[model samples]
Target: MPSFHHGAVEIAYLDEGEGEPIILIHGFASSKNVNWVYPGWMAELTKNGRRAIALDLRGHGDSGKLYDPAEYGIGTMAGDITALMDHLNIRRADMMGYSLGARITGWLAYRQPERLRSAIFGGLGIGLIKGGGPGENVATALDAPSLDDVTDPVGRTFRAFADQTRSDRKPLAACLRGSRELMTEQQAAAIRVPALIAVGSKDEIAGSADQLGKVIPGSQVLHIPNRDHMRAVGDKVYKTGVLEFLLRRP
Candidate 1:
């Protein structure tokens, strides 16, 4: 429940465990608990003797919410992560993110590679290079009054997830509008840190993990069987692969 100022917004975060730090970034409509804690990610990482930290992005969880779309740009979210890093006096740490968080990780890997010992991206892949985004359907879904009023399948699912999570709708909608930019192939190719992309074999939201690894050169890929985006975050296979990667690399 501890919080700090990052620019004009107050970012809330949880810092737990001990040893080498690893920041955990949750996906869209997910708080740190829903994304990492409830999934036993913190326990697993900490049990392995690594410090675990997670924060609510500006529009998500307990972070200060901004209704304006401009406040949730991809670059802005990346800055929030670095600002948290600065606040903690930690220069570099291994970091991991899922879905929207993975996209933010992509930005960080490009924008502040110096601040990362390694990067783990879950539920995202080469789609960043293909130029697609959540678009107006997702925004409209977030704006809809109820699930019955939503028609688009993807949007309906996200809207329902938001409702289930009790997320602030206005800010989440604005986030969908502002942070939809995916990474370009050139940017993905430019990542200089050790990285891993773990994804569900059935996850349609993230693009091809194989294509992403091929482009990143030396980046490892873990494709969890019989899982989708919603299920992939909590999957044991994904966690095992990531832990092994971090342990081996560290």
Candidate 2:
């Protein structure tokens, strides 16, 4: 795991294989390994002759953590991705993000479209517009003394994940506090880059993939069969659909 400084913060990342580059951003409480590597995403992309780059978003995995909610703004997090790209001298690359990562990617697509060749929004959907996912309860849950103290169903799940990942919950709580900005319909409609919205069919967290698709002009949607938010990341249909979309994109 190599790392570089994006200002005061150290962003840790994995760069694997070679060809066109694709950056993978994990969901909240998930590291690059947990989100992409262990799920066989690295193998699928690398074997397909693509350079797979994954990063530990600040406050998660090996990346530097900051406790101030102000430091974890959605744009601030997105800037970390651009900084990483600049560090590698990548003019533009395909970008894939899940859940929170998807929100960050969507921000980039709207504000910095030149930096992305294409965008993949996974484990996210119309919630990008509707503006509701983990909220104060999740943040409060992260700060709870123990997982047993987290009573909200979603909060408990995320707290458990944080514990499993051995993550420091304080910074995560701040991150959840800061990175909650939602996209406007105008912003989504303005995205011109080739885009794919992939969501699990059973994902209640991601709103509606079709609705998001309708908002983003010319974007494609893929529904992973019979899976939920957690199980959809590594689904074969998702990998295949993304690969096919990549191949077909100009």
lDDT of each: 0.89, 0.95
Clashing pairs in 2: none
The sequence of per-residue lDDT tens digits that candidate 1 reaches over residues 55-146 is 99998999999999888999989999999999999999999989889888889998889999999989888876774446689889999888
Q: Which candidate is the best by lDDT?
A: 2
TM-score of each: 0.97, 0.99
Model 1 scores worst on lDDT over the 10 consecutive residues at 126-135
lDDT of 1: 0.89
Off by over 4 Å in 2: none
